[model samples]
Target chain A: MRNPRTGWLLLSPTLIILLIFGFAPFLYVLFVGFNQWNVFSADDGLVFNGLDNFRRLVFDDDFLHSVGLTARFAIFAIGSEIILGFVLAQMLTRNFPGKSLFRIIHTLPLMVAPIAVGAIWRLLVIPGFGPVPFFLDRWFDLKYQIGSYPDQALWTSVIMDVWHWTPFVTLTMLAGLSAIPKEPVEQAKVDGASRFQVFWYVTLPFLRPVLLTTVFIRIMDAIRTVDEVWMLAGGGPGTRFTGIYIWRVVFPRTDYGYGSSISLITLYLTIVLCWLLFIAISGRRKGEVE
Target chain B: MKKRFTFILVIAIALLANMSLVSADMHGWWAEAAAPYAGATIRGVSESTPPSNYVADVLAAQFTELTGINVEFETTSWDQMYSKAINDMEANTGIYDFVYIEQDIIYSYLAQDYLVNLTQFAADNPDLAYEGYDESAFTSFADYFKNADGDLFGVPMEAFVKVYLYRKDLFEDADIMAAFEEEYGYPLAPAENFDQYRDNAMFFTAYGENMDMDLWGTTVQGSTGHPASTYEFLESIGPSFGLYNWGINLDAGSAMSANGGALDGDTAVEALTFWLSMLPFAPPEATSSTWDEVASSFAAGRAAQGWVYGENAAWIATDESRSAVTGNVGVRLPVTAPGVIEAAEMGDGYIGYYDGGAFGVPHSSRNKEATLLWLQFIGQSSVQAEWAAAGARITHTATFDDPLIAEQDAKVDGYYTLLEEQGPLFAGAPPFPFHAQVREVIDPFIQRAILGELSPADALSQAAAAVDEELSRLGYGM
Candidate 1:
């Protein structure tokens, strides 16, 4: 007594919505990517430029540099966030006075907007005047213009990203830790295993999926990071991330065709990275479903 | 009979007086013409500057009261304003009725036909033109937004020159002067050349160090991460060194002198090199500073001299709460190298950047007539005086002589006198349809030079090559 018409009707709304919201724009962008389409001077229909737009990307030094910078930023920011987030999550899991207060305090940074965090850090790290430079100079004898020097500016952005996003990873890790069964860990402890050994042998294996998921999410986010870096150094001091670079190409240059082509490249790169991570995660446990 | 005649005379006089008051009414005419478009709400976007904020918060409401046409003016940062306005127009969304057309970008807008021809629109609907609206009242600044054929494209809203602001207190100090003269073998005064400027910067910086105070010789807008850094170099610093029209040679249509342009010529290289050399003498904040921060540094007495935008000229001199050196600030035309002024006067170059923007009706706007009325309302000569004083920007020729501005001239150490006398020396950005594209190609290289990633000569050479390549790709110099 199944009505095929009814089934089709039920799915039609979502199908239409997706076509309009997601598929249409994607297809239009694909069409634009193959042409010399300047939106401002778009009088005659898009001129067919074949792969010329994509070819331009190969020779664009700024674009290539941005892609490289984004990778470096991603590796530094996410790698640090994962390790630090896990440690903080573990510290919070232990029984202690004011544990809830500490948990709340630790998550405070996540509530703030990324751009605001960047601005606050910009103020803090300003040399000769900012509190950060003052304290670091007095306490550690470290004196440098943090946001003005090319090397230091990149590292400063990484630090701000970690400060703003580490809380998300920690909260996710804490949830996973709470859900893990205590039996294996307790048994290991009773068998005279040290704290580190018990955690490594019993707790870590169980937490593998959660760790992979959090890292994957963080990596994806780090690849597309823009706001904080924009507010802080504005992709300057030689720290032009992929996001800011693409923004400049599209808005300032107004070369929608070439910008779309570049954007498609980034999209494909992210997809490939995510696919590899997925495969690695699945292979870690032979029978586990991701 | 005599009492009856007197009563009639009194009534007649009262009626006539009321009639005369109505005749002189400014908004009464607007109210009559706007009857058809009353209650129509027009949205506009502009950078969040003093004049824009004033128009949004004060003038827009008054306009509504007079014309019954509501204006929803959204003031935002330059990037966001450009993005929103351009996107809306590109998409033909009719989301915005008016947009800010900066003098630099008008050429691009004109090329794209994104704006409605103001002159044509005015002619098409003569009924919509307000009584106070007179296109002739505007100064030559309006020419920046007009086509070669003399068709008006936008209504000039704000105009100002970027001038050099110095700490008069520091320059006048007897001890500092004697020390400077003893070291440099010249009287310590406002610099007239690059050499003098450099000596002053070095001398004051050393003086500050000796005194053990948190002060610097100059404020350099050297934020390598933002467009402000690039703008400062190209507009303020480069012009003084004789790099006019962005060093592009009109005859050869190239940026490289070998190809017959001056973009990478000796003067341009020296200009950028000198600009970067100020890093050591500037406040540490210079590396992350924009025009606003530079003004703040000068106003707070942290720096002895800096290039400050005219929009900030008034507040830095008049507003005590915000400006620490309110009473001791001096303003003058930026010092230039030898032959620079004469060359500029002879139409070979420009001395400084004449920065400003205008309001134009977007073609995608649903209520073009309503938007046109709003532009006219603001463009009226009577409104120019108050807006000029508030924003430190003047578009009308008569605004230079406004009593309020004249009064403010005395407060800011004759900043207005310099503006009135030397204003003709500066000019707006060259009318290039590829302005944004060329700037984008040049900005990063300039930023790299400031960050010490490239030598001045290498940066300029590379930038010139990139710009040449881009121009070719866009069919400019092919």
Candidate 2:
């Protein structure tokens, strides 16, 4: 009876915050999703078109194209962040001359703000005159660089995203890495196990839960990112992705119900991907426990 | 556990504090606070035109000096201005006292009953209406503003016609211009007809070697992924072809369909084909040029002539500014089509232009009283004359017709002559009730044709088919 009272007392603040900012909007989104309402006419009540919005998306070529682009972009961008993030986190775990400074530097991108990262990269990649392009051309004679073509622009946007966010993954992985018990590692070392063998067998298995969790979180975030891509390319060199595709629907042309349908599809995609990752994590953890 | 609860409590308080800080003052327009002397405070909005800045900052200062009323100006881009006006008016947001709208928005805005009828305002103040303002103050084409019942919603500011500009020095060369004039049987002024313009541009571009000039004859805006550039090209060529005549005339609609052609697959194909065929004569990379690029090309001395809006004049007058051929350029009317049938032989023989911006009110403004004051002040003969005199504003007839403005402003003479003689060439029409839908159908066709993704004929036909589908969905009678 005392624990129940304490639980209620402890959870009230969080529940209230989530209720107002999170649940309220989430509930309103249902009404918005069902109607032909727009930012201009949000007040003029719902048109009650039922599943008509979703029905249109089935035949919409732009929707299909955006879905494909998001999958491809997320796979490549998230893959890079995780691999690089894991390596950096591992390096930080070891003692080095400037380990403290390196740890501080790792957190710098996270602290600088996402908009600033986008602005900095946008200037460097501006096609003809930007110094980055100038220097690349001077060295390699690769005149047409990443800023001009749609696919190249997508990759450049991804690289800038990775630059800003890989650090967050590194910080999480560092905590996960440090949390591992020392006894198993000590035993492996005494038993003459090599560093690579010991890491693969002992350390990797132990940290699999945290790494999977971090990767799952990053995947969800990568799908929703609009601002960085918005600032970097303005979704151009012509839009080849979901974030920009959704923006075009919401703004420029105020096709509200259709845009809401696209957002709903994005939410579903996020849940399905993260759920799959969770299953894999559970299976791996269960194997280790056995 | 106690410490964690304390931390969470502090975070909740902090979040609430932050939210309060970021919230905007959402009280609908405060008429009393906005206006101290007048019965209501007037809040006006205009697009970020250079003249609007002058009016808001410099001229507003003068207006305030003359009449002590606190007025505030809200400004944004032309696109933003129209979208906001359409939204604010439709929703009755009451955030603005006066809104500067464009012709496109005016069509839709008038369809609704938000605008305060100008009849009462004009009747109450006769000197403010036609009595003080003369025909000279306005372009000849001011009749469009009259509603079906012969009522005015907004006042005309200026007659905007497409002024075909070229490098005078480049045209002055005898050897090059002699051949052009002899072939065309007129001065090598800008093309007066669409066919003549195309042929003349082709000749100039091909003989670039003989002319000893590495210049193309014409450039057009293609870069921006919208229908505005297409609309410019369409308006310039449509009258020549007789596609439309001042809105869809039900009596003449059949003739328009047969003679000029319908907005069907074939017509769409023909439209795209014509514009794409002229692509080579544009800048090498004109595939990426918008209206800004066209002006920049002219300013950089890269092209002989091009299509651009009138605001470029402000850019040109600043000699140390971005324009390369600042003082050397002159303006004229766009070219029309070649004579085909005996009757078609006459062609339209005129150019085309669309309106920049106009004003409208929303149904839901909290500050309707204050907004009415600004609307009246903006429509006043004295304010119009003053704005025109500054050389920065296009005049509504009430303002431009004032003899005081004509005497005061030098830039008004050249522009006035253009408006008087050629302003009737350009007229305003609604694109479609559902304009967003129209762009959805129109943009891909233009984009594809310019990118060489499809032949002009194929691209246009498909685009027309798409637009028709959208129109059918909207239940349009036409």
Candidate 3:
């Protein structure tokens, strides 16, 4: 019924690019997931092993441990990022002097590359040589090496993630806060609602969609955390995050088949988790409407 | 007038002819062989070590001048180099004409047929070999790059032995020695055995504490989450305790004791325990220290001793700007448990780790002939002395007697002499095609042990079991 030729012409470039870069690679991954492929094996030419690789995943303790670490990292990092971002957004939304400058300065961390962030933090936290250790000793007398000790390495990485990404969440929330209807706040005040009550009922409900979106984006991004952790802690001291674990399997180990399976598993889980979150949020909104 | 004019003209003609012949002689056989491939661009990738940097900066320019083939040699990190090279080879992409193959990965490269056999290539194309390329001049380290049939695959570029280095200033201090003797009932000196090593570590650590100095007894390559920590445990500490070949029982081809493998055997567990014991004596950064950090720590005078790579020895010993303890560093064979040498000699173990890398033409190379000429050009004996001096890694037997190396031996406190005399006691990693797989399974366990999440015995036991399971899955144990 529509002009199909013009529509196809308009979408061809993007579709082709996506097919070449994104879809093709995903299809290849799916294909390889069912085959036994080793990059270094001369004898085997992508031998089809069906579900063997997937079965192997069931008993892979290292992989399971990495999943646990990744989950913990996500909960702590994303949770902190959201709370700090909301607070900063609330503060910045008020009319104030040099508000633009403060906003710009807060976004500076977002401009730097994640790997550079990791490297800078590495320098800051090095024992005996770094300024951080010197000040900590002078003030707190705590002799903690942030990226070395098993107990501290993962948390240090989490703090770094928060520092890098909290600005993004703040920016998103700020946009949402600006678009909020002003009448609700006046009505709340006229009804003698306390500041906390107004915020809980009016501000939070209006910001729910934005908060859900930010959380989803962050959770997905957090699952793909590699560059900073690789540069700083190297997924070490028993903090082997899942992303680096898959990378080690694929590249270092050259077990392409198994790596592809793990990749698919990660992709499947991400999709399912995101879908569940979306459905739950939708259901809550429906209940509120009712 | 006619006779004088004729004589002057003939002399001028003769001089010009002689200059042309001299230029041709200097160009050498490689120039003639590469004449057809002139102006062709070839690419390579290698780790950004001093030696590789020298090759990229100095040798590539020289080779381009001599052979007329332009070489764009990328000096990159170890991870990127391996990834790019392997990807190119796997995909049959003619991106890299040549690749650096470390001793540890040569087995995987050969097993995969990713590399062209240099011996066969030479035999097939005698015209491509450089005039000065004598294979016999290469040291035994080159054997690591050869196949079971005694055919060469990669051209050895840099070879060195991992060695023990101590701060002479701390060992000879009278007060420290007296304290050590009173406490441990032995004179404080460069360690002779594991026991002495441990005692010295404990004493120096305590001594530093008493002096209120920010010092540690030793530096550990114990980045608990990196492959470097695993390498330190497997190569440096494991060999000294008589756990050879990564404690893998090759007789049964499994790492599990149930399959007769010794990966978690008594000797390996003991070695792992001893290695972890040094963690407390090591600087606080031990769990984050890689080879580079370890070298930096030793050079900064944060540690009394370290198992330093030979590549860093010359710079650490002579570069005053980098090394705070310049001229006070002493190099020796690592202190080993008793019977390690004998066990190595009797063909059951090794004393230390021999580490190096070589350049090989890949099968995917579009310009194999030109790349071959380039490899042979660097492998020439004439260039060995300069490269060895700059990189502090020698791969030729004749280089041991080179005047430049002799000069550096004195500068590095006889590091060259020790390597020349005791290099044979060391061995490269076993020829396992699944090297990265096995190491990945074990590396985390080592980090776990370092973090005290698992005891040494438990870590090794779990690691051995995991390795066995992996091996069986990969069709080894079956």
Best by DockQ: 3
Task: For each candidate, give its TM-score against the true structure.
Answer: 0.93, 0.75, 0.93
Going through the candidates in order, what fraction of the true interface contacts does each contain? Answer: 0.55, 0.04, 0.51
Give lDDT tens digits, candidate 3, residues B1-478: 9999999999999999998886577586767899999999999999888789889989999999998999999998677788889989988999999999999999888878899999899889988876678888899899998889888889999888889999998888887789888888878889888888888888788878889987899889988657889999998898999887787775576886777877798988999999999989998888888887898899988899878888888888888988898898999889889999887777777888899999999999999999888889899888889888878888889999999999989989999888888888888988888777788778888888887889989999999988887776565553
lDDT by residue (tens digit), candidate 2, B158-209? 3355557777767777876888777767767666665766776776776674
TM value for model 2:
0.75
Model 3, span A1-290: residue lDDT tens: 38999899999999999999999999999999999887554444789999999998878888898888888999999999999999999999897999999899999999999889988988887776778878988899988785456557788889889999999999999998998999999899999999999988889889989988998999899987888888877777545788988988898778899999999998888788888988898788788779
The worst-scoring run of ten residues by lDDT in candidate 3 chain B lies at: B469-478
How far is A28's C-alpha from truth in model 1 (Å)? 2.2
* Tens digit per residue, CA lDDT, model 1, B438-469: 88889888988887889999999998888788
Best model per lDDT = 3
Error of model 1, residue B264, in angstroms: 1.0
**Please, what is the whole-model Cα lDDT of each candidate in the order they appear?**
0.85, 0.61, 0.86
Task: After superposing candidate 1 on the true structure, give the runs of residues whose Cα lies further than 4 Å from its correct spot.
Answer: A1-15, A40-45, A127-129, A137-141, A287-290, B1-24
Ranking by DockQ: 3, 1, 2
Q: What is the lDDT of candidate 1?
A: 0.85
lDDT of 2 by residue, A51-92 (tens): 878887889776787777777778888888888988999999
